[model samples]
Target: MIKSMDEFTLTINGKQIETKETIGVINPATEEIVGHAPVASKNDLDLAVKAARSAFPKWASRSFEERSELILQFANAISENQKELASLLTLEQGKPLSFAEREINMAVYWLKESANHRLSTEVLEESETTYIEKHYTPLGVVGAIVPWNFPVLLAMFKIPLALLSGNTLIVKPSPYTPLTTLKIGEIASTIFPDGVYNTLSGDDALGPMITGHPGIDKVSFTGSTATGKKIMESAAKNLKRVTLELGGNDAAIILPDVSIDEVIQPIFWGMFLNSGQVCINAKRIFVHHDIYDKFVDKLIEYAKTVRVGNGLEPASQLGPVQNLVQYKKVKNLIKEAKQNGLKFAFEGEAPRSGYFIPVTIVDNPPENARVVTEEAFGPIVPLLKYQSYEEVIERANRSQYGLGGSIWGKDIELAKSIADKLETGTVWINEIGALSPTIPFGGHKQSGYGIEGSVEGLKEYTNTKIIRINKR
Candidate 1:
């Protein structure tokens, strides 16, 4: 058992392996050391890969029903410890307690539903003279590297699917927010077989090691586009399978027919969830000139009501940026906008002590401005005005990153048409970030590739083989 959740250790081969070196986990709210996480080296990562490689065959041999049962147990275990995990998530990742709780709940839901899926051979052809079939088989061991933004949930996106598809795994949680994931690893140590599911925590060194490790058959990663490119390049060395869910400058286009009242709340939450750190959050907004000013006014009004503070507090609606690096990066974006003379629509106040940034909205920033083109990954968002549907659609699809986007309007047909034209992998009609376990989620262009949910996603953890026979 783990000695303490705060001082978390690495889980390798179903054992809590304490490291000689450790890193301090800071609370973004107060910038205080909440705990220490084991800093894994190349050797530690190698050991994890070796363990997973050895366990893959046996784990893969298990029946789908048996695997599903164990996955369900793991999900239930997470549910039982939901509160503790949620609090830990909030403390480490700096999202509010409420959002943290929701993340845990959604993670559990994903795990349970993922286990319910199955893979079977497809009968391609059958005749007196010939027979052919296509089978989906496990891809030895998966190295799942999860990000700080929605760490637990993103890890869940990898875990259940990889395991259920008969792949052993070594999870590398972001060093910035490794506590809750390590705690989950502790729970996993009890449920999974030795070497079947393992987790290691470390800084920059671990990622390259995981991607380049020959023993790791596949790598599933979720993070920035720039990092995703590097991971793809590294994985290519051994030609290991890779699934990347990268950065997204997702946009939400509000048509002239949209009800200002109807969309205000959804757009507000979409832009500011987790203080707008979401990969697919509405980073850019394209509003019709007919309702652009009104939309901005209502959105600013709603932004004022959100309370920003320490995530653990009962009343804090949004919390600080997850780490010092990201905090500085976001602050720089805000500063650049100010330097560029962008019009400010709304700027909420924040406490002085933490890695906090106010809810900053830039009004009608130029298409060429950084605030309009870049993925802020913070509370700062740009509301761009457009004169025509053609112009707005063109502007919305302008970015290099396209993970998800949404079209908001009263006319369902109009919204559907706009959503169809979106360059994103997932486009919501009259909604934002409405993700379901059964639906496949991925990205187009620089946002990264490979499906993350549904049977399509589950298959990414496996390899396809063809079987053919001849009858005499």
Candidate 2:
């Protein structure tokens, strides 16, 4: 049994409030209770919004350079404490320690990058006896909903950018991975004034409260498509601005010319990284007929070598699926696929415990299989073969979700050509899931809308104002 800690209370509007209801933070590897986080009630959400609203004017009035310098300090603090944060993340979230460390490093990168983003004066066209100018202003209190998969990194993407853009934030992290995010809030409170930034933890109920609150000017959410829709509906009541980064059933297309080994290596990383919990993971793979058999064999051979165990162990390449709910979902999906006549191949011995599902490959999986149609969000890859480029492109774009996809081949020109046909926000040619802070990330279709990261992300939290002057 996991020992319960005191409710993780946070201060909002310079007042501390503790909730009676607390959530158990579990370590999936051992099924032990790792920690406890407060389950914020509707009252807590109101306090958070009030804090953000109260702090907005002061934060927005500060010069960009001032905000930037403080954010840089926050970044430095994160770097100094990276190891501690990484360990906490692994304990609460169940990803490999290496992955956790990498996520912390990425968070630091985003902070520094966001701080460096230019937020100064811009010139508009001038004419005789007339002047015109454009300015960027903060969007008041922002409500951010982050996912558990990459808690710190994803939170930083919005927090620093929102702050630098002159907005105050009320951030609600996913219940599954609230530790790192709460730690971030702890660190920010030291430098940021009270109410400038606040962290809230709870179930889905808090989300609607935050997004629908009159005090919140905007909502930035990263999670499932269904939840994103719910957020949109709630935000519409108050007309709160929204930016959503939702579900993805990304595709990986292997063209005829590429050597299977070269392409498979990167695909393996995309499909299996963080135990395939990533939104942009290449869950569906389409290979040209000529290399289908060869690719499948090589993929299984390489997968068999993957090491799975407790994430804290250095030798473990894959960690347990984050929670029991996700574990059961993946297991049932695999069983259903098998019942539907899909062939399953595993690289190594499956774990005796129900939590550890091996790197599983299903060959010639039909489009109707849950593994192909839904976001498996686990270490399972369904392989399909296509005779020509046209047929494959059609199959790839048939899904309702279109967040991201990739094409792998030696002929860069051919791959690029095929990449254009796929209806995703971002397409990787010859690689998969290679995201950078400089690139804009989001989705199309049912995958959800609006962009995150890059210049677009900074713009998401700002209101553009135009000033016009006429002199006679």
lDDT by residue for model 1 (210-274), tens: 89989999999999999999999999998999999999999888888888897799889899998
TM-score, per-candidate, Cα-based? 0.99, 0.96
Model 2 misplaced regions, further than 4 Å: 1-7, 14-17
Q: Candidate 1: minimum summed lDDT over ten consecutive residues — where?
A: 1-10
Write the residue-wise lDDT of candidate 2 on 348-399 in tens digits.
5545663777788888877788888899998888889899898999999999
- What lDDT does the true structure give each of the candidates? 0.91, 0.83
| Alpha carbon deviation, residue 123, candidate 2 (Å) | 3.5
Off by over 4 Å in 1: 1-3
**How far off is residue 311 in model 1, in Å?**
0.7
